[model samples]
Target: MTQIAQQHANMDETLMLEYGKGNDTAFAELYARHKGPMYRYICRQLGSKQHNKAQELFQEVWVRVIDNRNNYTVEAKFTTWLYRIAHNLLIDEHRKNQVRGEHLTLVSDEQDEGILAFHQGKQEGSVHNDFLQQAIKHCVELLMPQQREAFLLRHEAGFDPSQVCEIVGAKPETVKTRLRYAMSQLRDCLQRKVGATEVGGEREI
Candidate 1:
């Protein structure tokens, strides 16, 4: 990595440490740096059907961060710690849904721009690409919750498998199996939608 980018990447831990020491400005900086991706993560987790609840949960995640500042440690990357909190909150939400007998599914309200950009760069024909996006989203919603979480943490949050294991509190092999199953399901579903080999028309997951 470039020296400048490396320095910026390291700032998250530094900012959180400062915040632990009660530096409000440091806390603000940390929030601003992370809020966008983190909020989107929550929104995608709940899907558009529960956007209002997603907003509440998003705020709660930050509130927990603020509440726990003094207890923060530098043992891991700040993003890892932050996402671990989110993972736990999502688990609570799933349990609540189960108790209420609500069918739980994770669908994106909109196509992820990152995924779209990737397809755009690699494929021609917008119409086919759009269909592919919708197919992928549909298949994702059908993933089992454990598999879906592992998939999103790896793809959406750009976390490596080890970091995903940490966030989800799963063994390395468990997380890997989840990811493998998710990819297989998505690929199989997409192939059924667009015909054989089309899953690779843009790029492999």
Candidate 2:
């Protein structure tokens, strides 16, 4: 690795600790690293109409991160900690507004195509890829908020079921069920486009 690049490759927990010790540079580096994906996640969750509110919540999350640095721990991944704060803030916003939006399932398209590739018997990568993209987009819109959030945490954020339960404050079975229901609904929604993916919808999640 290049000398400067190597220097920039600090582990998330290590950077968190460094920032906790009042190193402004460490905090800046950490912020720069996660800012994009974090902002995208917030925007996706809150949607376009609430962009201003999303920006406000984004700042609020960072403020909490900075203020609570002394109490940060390495027991979980830094991104998980960050997402938990965002998720809780979103929940708070929902409670305060007495609304949770329209329960849309729009997610960022920057995720690995794997999030769109759940076909069991159908091809993984083939000519229908373009068609499947639209199908996935339409299908995702069918998911409820909990289902969509669970799906994003697992697929986009790469959190496993247990970590998802922790970050989402849900039970083990509940998290798994949410994932199953999400995939099932998406699969069912686009079955014709998916072309015999062999996914089952009988399971309750």
Candidate 3:
């Protein structure tokens, strides 16, 4: 195999270790591989409308990753370690908002309030691109935080249930349940929004 192919195939943990040992190239490659999804994951957590805020947080995540390179262990999945940082930073923001008496609207499992209300769009039979995006975002925002976190970590970040457990510090069964609930909620919400029984084509999101 070509050297380029080998580099491309390097595991995240390996790249992290290499970066820890001062291999800037490995760190660059790892960032390239992870940046897109990491940004999206943060957006999904923070809200897509919070674009500038999300960008700021995304930069912070990378900065933390760089500064804490020495703290990473080869035993844990690199993505899990990265996610733990992201999650904690978000929690810190939530706490800050609370302290200022400016709490962000949270998804309540009971009341089912959505971030975006597009009731008329649902009856329209077909939702085009922008509408679809809004619908999915609204659906996501309606989910319980734990459920949404698990879903984004699993689907957006490509982490398995075990890795998700490690990142979230939840039990394996709890992680599985969160993922299941998240998928179920998304599927139902999207189906109602777009008049479809499925989501993400045949992939089920």
Candidate 4:
């Protein structure tokens, strides 16, 4: 990898260790680096229908980071540890919703601009591309909770299956199975939506 790539690979872990040492600037850097993707992850997990609740959980995730700085360790990548906290909180929220007999519902792509932008890519594409993006998001939301988490972590966070296992506290085989199923389901869903000719003809992830 290039020098910048190497730097970025270790930057999160370094910033986190500095934050643990009470370096507020380090904490700021860490937050700025991760805020967008982290927020998007929470919003996707909670679904856009609970935008307000996703915001609360997003804030709570950071607060927990601050409170537990002293307990931070380098056993895994900082993102892994960070998302683990988020995963736990999401589980708790899901449990509460379950007890209330509520299932989170997915909304339109407009519900989360960051995630929409992600699906849209960096530059604008054709109208067909836009429709495909929307269709992809809808299919992602249809996945079972565990499958969704694994898929998002792999695609959004760019983690490998082992890293995803660490983040979601699942075995390697389990994470692989989830990802396989997610991709298979997404492929089938997209094929049905836009026809098989358009499916797997675009991006791989």
Clashes of each: 0, 0, 0, 0
**Residue-wise C-alpha lDDT for candidate 1, range 102-163, written one tens digit per residue:** 75673443434444444543454556667687668767776888998899888887788998
How well does candidate 1 match the true structure in TM-score terms?
0.77
Residue 178 lDDT, candidate 2, scale 0-100: 93
All candidates' TM-scores? 0.77, 0.68, 0.74, 0.80
lDDT per residue, candidate 3, 137-178, as tens digits?
A: 778877777888899889888777888888888999999988
The candidate, 1 or 4, that scores higher on TM-score is 4
Q: Which numbered prediction scores highest in TM-score against the true structure?
A: 4
Clashing pairs in 1: none
What TM-score would you give candidate 2 relative to the actual structure? 0.68
RMSD, one per candidate, in order = 6.6, 9.0, 6.9, 6.7
Candidate 4, superposed: residue stretches over 4 Å from native: 1-6, 105-125, 195-205
Q: Would you give me the overall lDDT of model 2?
A: 0.73
**What's model 3's TM-score?**
0.74
Candidate 1's displacement at residue 158, Å, is 1.5
> lDDT of all the models against the reference?
0.80, 0.73, 0.76, 0.80
